[model samples]
Target chain A: MIRHSLREALLSLWRNRFMNLVASFTIAVSLLVLGLFLLLAHNLRSVVAAVGSQVTVSVYLRGDATEEQRDRLMDSLRGRAEIEGTEYLSPQAALEKFQRLFPTMREVAGELEENPLPASVEIRIAEGHRDPDSLRQLAEEMKRLPGVDDADFDLPWVTRLRDMVAMARAAGVSLGGVVGLAAILTIASVIRMTIYARQQEIEIMRLVGATRTYIAAPFLLESSLLGILGGVLSLGALYAIHRHLAASQGGLVPVLRDLLTTSFLPRSTSTLLLLLGLAAGALGGLLSLRKISL
Target chain B: MVELYHVNKDYGRGNHALVDVNMAIEKGDFVFLTGASGAGKTTLLRLLFREEIATSGKILVDGMNVSTLSAFRVPTLRRRLGIVFQDFKLLSRRTVFENVAMVMEVTGVPRRQQRVKTYTVLEMLGLNHRVRSYPLELSGGEQQRVAIARALVNEPALLLADEPTGNLDPNLSWDIMTLFKTINIRGTTVLVATHDKDLITRMGKKVLTLDCGRLITH
Candidate 1:
């Protein structure tokens, strides 16, 4: 029975090749839109993770503070659990680092009578304490220490970046949902048209004592084939677009270049996308079958 | 083996298609249903196959109540019977071989059996040479022969034909009736509906005649 149905389905598809192609292409375009949004969300998540790993706070000591006061401040900071580790740069060492960073200004630094760069300690925040509120509280505590002149961190910038990533993900989900629905509906209408074209065949099948399942099997198989074809087509289009963007990063702006460096969807995600296509196609076929008396 | 008791079919608004029609045919009997157009001949055949349920009476085909058969069981009842129509109803896109094999395929016959059975039936109808031809590529008589091959492929217990030869010429119609008789001789009960008076007179078989939804002769 299955073999017979499959043969019938293949014959129908070949007979209506042009209409089926149009339907598949429409599904592919809709899936492509959804895939593009997913790619954007995926890349943004990578950016957030990269930025989060580098989160740190820098504390500058008062120039007139005694060595004993600075030592006590260091000891207190080291005792805190939120401080992962700290690197201390003396006044002379800070000046040397500044010269290395700004090579053109090295001559001006050399002409100075004394080192003017402040002695600072770079504090790495622990993974568990990386949230905005925790980091802000830690910075406030550091600023009140006796030998600390100021505590600085890009708190607002990191917070805003996180917010933007969240918003991008939300938008991707919404757009994908809407576009996926449209793709399913398109497939359903296409199947409906195929059913209409084969109405005579269906009536004959009925007269020959074909059960409902026997009559429906071929149509269901046709819909599923269309969906799977659409999925493969969209995946190929997505890969080509990703490859083009990745290969032409040199001409892109700094932000876009960074985004281009991110990898494509992972294996599990790609498989999930294909499954989505299969489900949409099956659902579309079922929706069209509802109208048939069989 | 078919029986109808007070079967009434109405198309609503005082338009009666079959009215209180009652008849019986024993197993292996060959009978013809004769009437002019709109004489309820077609309606009587339709009721026997459950294509259109009777508005009010009982229909028994091979001891199964067709009048009250559930939708889910209609296929089962039909599988025991063969039905043919005026239009031939052959799938034009399929080859002659495929058209005959379709009946067995739907009933879950194996591939090897389907091929063998389909070929044997085509040979019986003298259509084996045209197995590869499409429906439109064949003559009207040939197409009707293919339709008969399809109906008989399953070896049904009863054969019901509604104007099966309506689209053919007089000679073709006689040939088709001869084919039906040959099939009936094989012990399958046959019931045919037609308005061909001369053909009916020549065949000289048991016939049930109707006039305006009422059975006038039996």
Candidate 2:
């Protein structure tokens, strides 16, 4: 019976193409606003993920530390929280790594009689626990160890990037919430006006003995359909924005080294858009139902 | 069956719509409720349909106390009754077929069954050819016929017509009154509220006259 009512409602909407178009237009505009924020939220997450993965906090060893003390320091660093992987690089290994990175630096090393570099324990923090404050605390704690002279984060750019990403995430969530609420209100009012215009028809149906559910089904279905269409339109708009961003500001997204880096909308975000559209439509229908009678 | 016992309807501010109206209508009986303008004829119909509650009296239709009927269950009571409006209240946007089929649709009739029943009713009214036509495109008589078709499609146990012929010419008015007669003959109780003296007198049937909200005769 409910399904039949839905079919009837959709049929009624289809019959009034102009009215349906007006309704769809309202829904589409709301969805565009919603999708824009969703894209921001999604990109913020990706940016955070990229920067977090690249963050590595390295601990420098004391210049005169004994091999045993260095090994102990390595064990202690390994046991610490947020430590990804640790490598105890001997002064020669450090030199070799430096030489490998800059072949021209080998001549400078060759000119010096004594190796000036210190043997260091390089620590990488796990992506999940890579918070700036937490990493800074961990580094300080490691430096306090008897064999460790100082702690150095290999990636100096991570501090600013982490802060920027955090700010972006906060802003994105805030914008997303505001835009989502606006979308709901927009759809609700549109549906409300539509229901108001048809109040007479509804009253007639009520007088003619139509059930509340019978009258509500069509409106609910229409709302849902509107939401779905809005969702699709939002997704399309979001995608277009993403493509334009990637073209105009391709390098804005960090870690562009890997070709896998993309500003595309996430699968979850797209699914959310679809669900949001449907939910908006359903909610709009309910809102209109509450205000109008059968 | 319908019965109104000492029904007094007051709309606040000392305005009385129906004053102690007492009347009784038997099952499958036909009746004309005659009165001039503002004589409580429409109000009487509204009371029977449970559209308005009598302030102080017992009103029962088909053994259900309408005066005490809750708003929620009003639709159920209405389902057993068919109402014809003066304006022919057909949804002008819908085709004649859809307009008539809506009643059966409300009753949860399947599409196929509704189609068959609607076609049968339209055929009976000799409107089978105009089934696909919109109500606005139809003449006044045809529109009235469509309204009648909608009211009768559900096979309601009770039928209420409120000034059904107000907009019709004499011939069309007679035709509509005859349509009501044919429906009443099919074992459906019919109550027509109209000021058409000639049409009412010619049909005879039981007459319930209202004078300024008071039941003058039954």
- Strongest candidate by TM-score: 2
TM-score of chain A of 1: 0.81
Model 2 residue A194 CA deviation (Å) reads 4.6
Docking class of 2: medium
lDDT of 2 by residue, A137-236 (tens): 8888888888778886655566565565566456655665566566666666766766777776777788788878877777788778877877787777
Q: How well does chain B match by TM-score in each candidate?
A: 0.98, 0.97
Model 2: colliding residue pairs: A223-A281, A227-A277
TM-scores of the first chain across all predictions?
0.81, 0.77
DockQ (Cα-based) for each candidate: 0.68, 0.58
Model 1, docking class: medium
Q: Candidate 1, which segments miss by more than 4 Å at Cα? A: A55-156, A249-253, B216-218
For candidate 2, lDDT tens digit of each residue in B28-84?
899999999999999889988887778899999988888888877898888888899
Q: Candidate 1 lDDT, tens digit per residue, B1-218?
A: 89889989999999999899888999988898998899999888878888888999999999899988998999998889988889999999899999999998888888899999999999999998999999999999999999999999999999999999899999999999999999999999999999998988999999899999999887
